[model samples]
Structures are given as C-alpha cells and as structure tokens.
Target: MAASSAVEPTSFDPSKAYKEWEVNGKYFGDGREVALLDYIYNHPDIEQLRGNPEKILRAIDAFAQSVTGLINIGENKGVIVSDVIAQHKPEVVLELGGYIGFSAIMFGSAMKRAGGKQYYSVEKSPLFAAVATSLIDLAGLRDTVRVVVGTGAEGIQRLYDNGLLRSQIGMAFFDHHKPSYTADLKLCERLGLIGKGTVLVADNMILPGNPPYVEWVRASVEDKRAMDKAAQEKGNPNLQYNSRFVKSFEPSGMEDALEITECLGIEGA
Candidate 1:
C-alpha cells in the first residue's frame, strides 16, 4: 500500500560507484550486451559463479561499477522487486524485457526462494535473450527461469498458446519498450492472463514516464470503457484495478519510480 522507498533504502549508495549506462543516440541494443557476457564468462571467479545467484549478482554489480556500464535494474531497484516477490509469493513471474538477464536472475532467485514455479523473461532481441539465458543458467536458474526471444505480444501469445501461461500471472514485471507497456498489458488482459490477486509492476515510470500506461491502470472501468472506444488495444474494461506509485532510485543515484497495479476483479459491464 505504501510507496516502494517506504520500506527500501531511499538513498542510493554513492560509494558503490556503478557506471552509468552507456547513452549515445541509443541506450541499449549495442554490443554491450555480448560484451557483458564476455566479461562475466572471463571473470577470474568463473567457477564461483556457476551456481551462486547472489554471488553472480554481486559480480555483475562489480562489472557495472568498474567495467562498462550495463542497463540492468542494479541492486537498488532490483531489491525493491525482489522484496515484492518475497511478500507476494507468486507461483510464476513474467519479465517483459530482460536485457542480459539481470532482473531475470534477481527475480528468478527470489521466485525460487519463495517456492515459486517459473520466471519468464521475454526479450525482443535474440542476442540479448541469448545473453540472458546464459547468465540465468550460470546463476543456476535454468529450471526456474526461461528466456523467450520475441516481442512482448509474441511472447505472451506464445506462452499462452503453449499453455505455459494459461494460469493467472501472479506477478508481471514490465521493463520493455515503454510504449508497449499498455498494449502488452491489454493483450494479457484480453487473453485472461490477469485475474484476481494478479500484480503488475511497471518500471521506468518516473525517468521516462508512461502517462498512458499509468492512466489506464489507474482509470475506472467506466473511464477505460470510454477510452477503449478509440483504443487499438481493447482490454477488458470491466476488470478492476487498485494502483499506486512507488518512488525509487537508479543504481546510478538517479530518481525513478515504479507503478504497481493489482487486479481487483471484473467490474460490471
């Protein structure tokens, strides 16, 4: 019910000195992902990383701090999601965008500890998905986490069609293409992937801001119905939601926020 920073550490530890994510004309989709693989695989403590999730996370954090910057959730924001996973005890967790598997490993480890089932990381880029898969495996989460290479829509449809995601999604983490957040969520709704007690955690809400996604999640069923008249994504307007905003910080000490939404159930048509 309270904001994310309410329970977590509000201050980013500057002493950690995590390298800022490389930002030129582009933020990701460069050679950095593969390079990260190289860095991890080549680390001196390679053997220690084989089956240690927390150690692997620490190593990755070290790489981000001293080596090339990575666009990962980092320890700061990652801990927030991990804590939610602990409290919610979701049977299955879905990750929209897993660039090199940082969030996947983090949340997957949490899922495993919480006695959850699976963690699905849907990445648009095959290259990134491959990297994420390798890292997740290295973290000993190969059984707990699976990486799917495709757009959010494709991944959702594939999993649903395959009956892997037919059950209600206990918790979904959205960190993919910002614009697709609402569309992808709508797709999930249309497919009945969301139900009572389902939780949706959307990242990068404050830094880049997702007004449309936020509006949709927070809107009343009547308002959503009105919007659906002209919307391309015809989600279940009758579905009810209780939403809130959680303030947090980037690993690099930048300000950001996460929008958490829980499905209350279907409202009257």
Candidate 2:
C-alpha cells in the first residue's frame, strides 16, 4: 500500500445520539421497505418528490425516523462520499449494496450533479432490488442509476461480461456483508475493475471493524506481497492504496467511519 492519506479539517461537533428505536434490530424482510414505498407514494407532497432527490431522501429519512429504522448510509456519512464524488467526478460509481435504494438515490443524485454518467447499485436480495428500482424510478433517476440483483462478485462479473464496466471503475462503495468486504474488493482487483485514480469507500469501519479489509488497504506493497501467500483470494498485491479514516455518525447516531482508499497506482510496475 502507498502512504496513508491525511485526514482533513480535524474538527467535528458532537453528534446527537440515535433514538432508541433508530438502531437496526433483527427485523428486516418484514416489508419495511414496502412500507417506506407506501409512505412515500401516499404522502401529500408526493408530487413535489418527483425528480427531486432531496425530497425523496427526506421521505426516506422520515420513514426511518418516525417509523422503523433502516440500515442505510445515512445523511452524515453520505455527505462524505458526495464530497469524494465531487472531487473525483467519477464517470461511474458502483455500490456493493443498495438497501431500499437510499444510498443509491443519494449518491446517484450526487454523481449526476457532478456530471457523472451512471451509478450502479448492486443488491443481492431480489426483493430489495425491486423495491430500490421502484424508488429510483420514482426519483426520476432511472437513466442515471441501475439496480443489479446479485452478490457483489456476481454483480461485478455480470457488468464486466456485458461490457458495461470494462475500463477502470472510477469509484467503488462497499456497504454490504461485513466479512466479505476484502474478498469482494479482491475480486474487483482480479478483474481489473479498480485501477489508478480509483476511489474506494467502505462503510462500517468503527461500529463493526473490518481488520482484514483495512489491513489490506493500509498495508505496504511489500507487506501485501508477503501476505499474498496466505490469502484465499488472489488480488493484485501491486495495487498501491492510500487510505484515510473519516469519522462520521451512523443514521442511528452511533459513531462510525468510512475508510476512503484511493488507488494511487500499481507498485513496481
């Protein structure tokens, strides 16, 4: 890995604690996503939500706050990625998860505003993907975003096989299975989806730390090469990365952070 990137600003206010009901529990797949859609579609301000990402996001936030809590990359952490998008101006943004299309709509809107072409939200659950597609279409971003239903690796391969993601992936966002973060990233590395100038944003660093993924991104190139023999997957050890830990608040008001890693270049090429 390359030298770590310097964290910025160095100033942050105390974030409010999440409401007791705001944190997620073992209550997914109970049609909460559908309830969110119902709430949005039935709102008196539904007309104003059309083609309005902000309003749509507000509606989602409203559902999460007033209703059941959703496990999403909430407004706080979301802004961090949007700032990254503004700086990188990636032509395409790929997300490993798209729970109910919250992050998809949020970041997809940012990508479009930044003059990017596409934002791909890959969700393994077909049900969630369907719900996301409906919400994304409702946001009138059907052209700017697409929801792929499959595992992260499958999603990458499907896109690559179809030639929609042949060149370097401008940005990759990881917010899926905690343990698979490194494995999925390695798959992308193997497929050459990630390259120089690529930005990788991974969620759930503090709340549920991922040492393997963080170690891989923060390791020295020589260290990575040495560790390659013990790895289960064969990612390019030569891909140099510059990582930074950006602290932020989870939607539940719990302290969390995103690991923003940039592929500076391949090492010893």
Candidate 3:
C-alpha cells in the first residue's frame, strides 16, 4: 500500500455569481442620497397629510423629487428655476413644458410666496396638461398658475390672440424638448414678449445635452466680443452679458444641467 493516496474534494455549483462590478460599484452623492431618502420617506404619507398647507408643500416637494428620481436621482432644474424666480420676485413668469405639474407646483409655490406673480405654463401634451391642471387645483394654486395645452410657439400665438401675451414676461423657463430651446427663445424675442432684464433659464444642458443652443450662445457672445471691443474703443463701456450654470448631482460627478442666463435688453443695459 503506497501510503494511501491523499483524497481531495472540490466544491462546484451550477450557478456562478455574474457579478456586475460597475452596477454594484456605483456610488451616490450624499446630497443625492438625502434627496432620494427624503422623497421616499415623505411621498407615501402625502395623501394622509393633504389637508395641512405646510404638509401639502412638503408633499409637493417630495412628489417632485419622486418624479425626478424616476429618471435621475438629483435636485430638479424646475426647483432651481423657481428659486431664481422667487429671488427675483418677478411679476410674470412663462414656462415651456409643464410635465405632470412638477414644475408648475414649484413655480406656483414661488409665485405664491412672491405675491402678485402669475405663471403661464405651456405644455404640448394634453394628457400632461390635464394632469398638471388637476395637480395645480389640488395644490390650491389654480389662481396663480395656468397650464395651457400646446407647444410654446403655438401657445404664444394663442396667448397673444387671447390678450394674455401683451404683458411683458419677466422670467422664462425653457425645459421642453432640447431642440426647441433656441427656437422658442427666438420666438419670444421676436414677439418682444420678454422684458428688459428678463431672466431665461434653460434646463437639461448636461445630461440630455443642448449643444446646439450652447454653441449658438457661445458664437453669439464671440461675435459680440468684437462689437464690445469697438464700443470700448469708442469710449462706451464694453457690452456685458452673463450666464450662471447650476450644478446637479450625477452618479459620476457633479454636472451642470441648468443654465440661467439673463438677457439685459437695451433699456436694462
């Protein structure tokens, strides 16, 4: 007996761990986690606390966060736009794309706080507009915010025809289809709807990306640079323009998703 051969046993399993390293390795920002957790913690209790005004506002914020989380776990551009509008205390606000009333609720809340501000939201989807209208009513902001079912371009015409666009729009929010951003802004400009010192905010500049509009703005600014230089040479102050980028949390890193650019017309300039 040659010292009995050592026996060894090997363990085997039919199913192997198909580990997705990237999926499991992804990390969320603390801010994103907090926003998502708060949304989750509050959303389910919204209906139960609907009657209270403070709770309703919190619920609206949570609902907006929930909707945002469905696609991207981050702070919403609408909320940022609303905050800017509120800070400016604009008398009139025009919004393109009212989706499920999230932006509308944010805008309405800002308007309510600003006092005497009115919001006009144009949405191309009738179903979305209907939902927005219902939500507006539920939020008790029907009197402050109006949701119109139509593309902003068409809706602007209708509003003008209806005598609603005659007033100078102080702030405009562009959050609709990315391609339509520049066209809609031009349309409003051609109509002379935006007043001097008007603030125009464009969202989804990073993730969904609006390079065309961004490039156009850059080109326009570059072209203006020569004129500005000439103006400075002529003893006139160099023409000045500014844009502010608002950052949003991304799984990878912080990204700018919103561009809040103010257009200072001749009067304001």
Q: Sorted on TM-score, highest at the top, how do the candidates line up? A: 1, 2, 3
TM-score of 2: 0.93
lDDT of 1 by residue, 138-251 (tens): 998999999999999999999999999997889999999999999999999999889888889999988899999988998888888899998877998888888878888887
Comparison by lDDT, 1 against 3, better one: 1
TM-score per candidate, in order?
0.94, 0.93, 0.67
- lDDT (0 to 1) per candidate: 0.87, 0.87, 0.59
Candidate 3 lowest-lDDT run of ten: 1-10
Model 1 ranges off by over 4 Å: 1-9, 23-26
Clashing residue pairs in all predictions, respectively, total 0, 2, 0
Off by over 4 Å in 3: 1-79, 218-241, 250-256, 267-269
* Candidate 3 C-alpha lDDT tens digits along 151-177: 988987788789888856778888777
| Cα lDDT over the full model 3 | 0.59
Cα misplacement distance, residue 67 of candidate 3 (Å): 9.6
